[model samples]
Target: MRTTLLFAFLLAALSGFAQDNFTITGDGDGFQEGDKIFLSYRSVKGFIEDSVTVHNKSFRFSGSVSGPVRASLYRNQNPKYANVIFDAATVYLEKGNITLHSSDTLRHSANAGTPLNTDYDELRAALRPYFDKLTTLRDPYELSDQEQKDKALVARLKSIYHNQVDLMVPVQFSFVDKHPSSYVSLVTLSELIRDSRWIDKVEGSFSKLSPELKSSVLGESIKQKIQLGKRISVGTLAKDFAQPDVNGKTIRLSDYRGKYVLLDFWASWCGPCRAENPNVLSAYNKYKSKGFTVLSVSIDEKKDKEKWLKAIKEDGMIWTQLSDLKGNDNLPYKIYGITTIPANLLISPDGVVIAKDLKREALHSTLANIFK
Candidate 1:
């Protein structure tokens, strides 16, 4: 009876161990013995970290995790390779074995294991071809010198890039919508929120997340961004903010309250913002006498004041321009949740945001209609 009881206890112990532990094996061509492979996972409490040593061009990591977690891999001595591994070698660690296969350069990798990892792999698989297509399209070497110098070619490339971006949004948002319970959805939403065009979709996805996911740190942060979104949306009152103009005098958004204001957010370093200045200038020229005025808010830092002023003069943007020289952390950007710029809000005489992100012909069209 004693012998039988001891065997039963050992079997139970083994069963518990199998339920709580995970193992990862990575195989690549260039890793040498004793090289370290680091792993980190995001959890509710924060990131949990672990590492293992490479031996014979391979490495293995084994540990117990409280739950299935998405983790990334990294190694020492090669920051570029580490980025590749981080970007493509993510795996979901659960109570099972995970495997990674990579090339000598770590430029490409594959993961097989838990469901989340499988989902991630599927996403990458679907998007990889599109990315390759974009890379091909963007290859300047493929263009003739004359074609490269053509302004129309630059405009065409920008259009192609924007169209590609439009295609990516639905694919990523579909993943989030279909997998509301998955933490991967949160990651997808985070990426989508970086573009102001997708901010509305991010808000839509937030309502669909599972309770546990909604309570996570990322979820809460996204919630706060949504709140900021509300504050800046069209029809809401544009929040008043003050910053120093190029001449170091204080200017407030409220000071322009009685006039139709083109509240513009831009930076000296922004190529798109610089490109769009002529359209803005044209609108100002056409509409300034008719109660509409452009109040430019620069997100440029104090260190870049010279460049900011130079850009103003070069672009011929003769208007009320203001910046605290605080870059992105400036009051206007913070209050308005302004991420990407060349962004603008058209404010009415009553201080309500009447329109936003008016670009190129749209700015001219809107002003023509408004002042007509």
Candidate 2:
């Protein structure tokens, strides 16, 4: 399963609360006088972005947040150089004074002096080893091109990667269980839900949250996601919707009835989605003549139509591609409750969702079996 960060969704769900003040003080060895630092977080009004100038090699910011909201500090904002100088730090903005320290770049900064930030740091410390292990195990390029073609080697790598994820899930859930009232707990649960394959476990864990936490904006959003997830579970008929193809022709899911269809949800900006395209293309080639076809829905923004078209051509995706150019609000995307990219539904000839999220070797094996 692919994981997507839903910070925007979580921030949007926040309810109104009495205003609480926060102050952030930071210093970095690499900072110079008059250097600009940008801080961004969600507010009740919507997204909030502000910048501060360094004085005497230190910077300070004061703000009011209704409740704890995740905020990021950036060293650079130039779009062209942003990726190159991607120095940033995340801290939970809450009621109190928060401190940030970095020897060189904000990327390696440490946040403290606030309850939520402290807990966030502790959680990161606890999970660092597991994340490191997963990093080492999940590098697809670690193997030679010929070795990557070996199904057994790929499967083994995937199995090991999943094992690491399984081990990490409990630690995350335990943090939520231990810090029921902490806003950080809600954030942790949201992250877990993003990558978790176990829906029942996710639902159960959500149910265990404190009433106050459960009724919070993020909680209600999560509740709705779980409900929507159940609707598209295996055996449920795939929901039908219409979207415009690249040539501006309307296409509907029902139009593809009487043949197997893979409802592929992806975006050009998504690295994982791009990486998985080759596998999807391979599956399409192997099964297209066998009454199977791929229908891709891109969540690319309206402004990125060129990027979308360019990606489709570069990926050599001969399959039909569709999108509404509505980014996250893409109608069919929300209808299916998809929160992550590289998600798909394998619909049987009768339009029943036979399987979902098949990838890598699983995609090949499943298609092989169906065609055989």
Top model number, lDDT = 2
- How high is the CA lDDT of each candidate model? 0.78, 0.84
lDDT of 1: 0.78
What lDDT is reached at residue 59 by model 1?
86
Over 4 Å off in model 1, which ranges?
Answer: 1-24, 28-97, 102-107, 139-150, 254-262, 266-294, 299-320, 326-329, 339-342, 348-352, 358-372
**What tens digits encode model 1's per-residue C-alpha lDDT throughout 205-239?**
88899998888767888887777656688888988
Work out candidate 2's RMSD over C-alphas. 8.7
What is the TM-score (0 to 1) of candidate 2? Answer: 0.76
Clash totals for all candidate models = 0, 0
| Highest-TM-score candidate | 2
Q: Measured by TM-score, how close is model 1 to the native structure?
A: 0.67
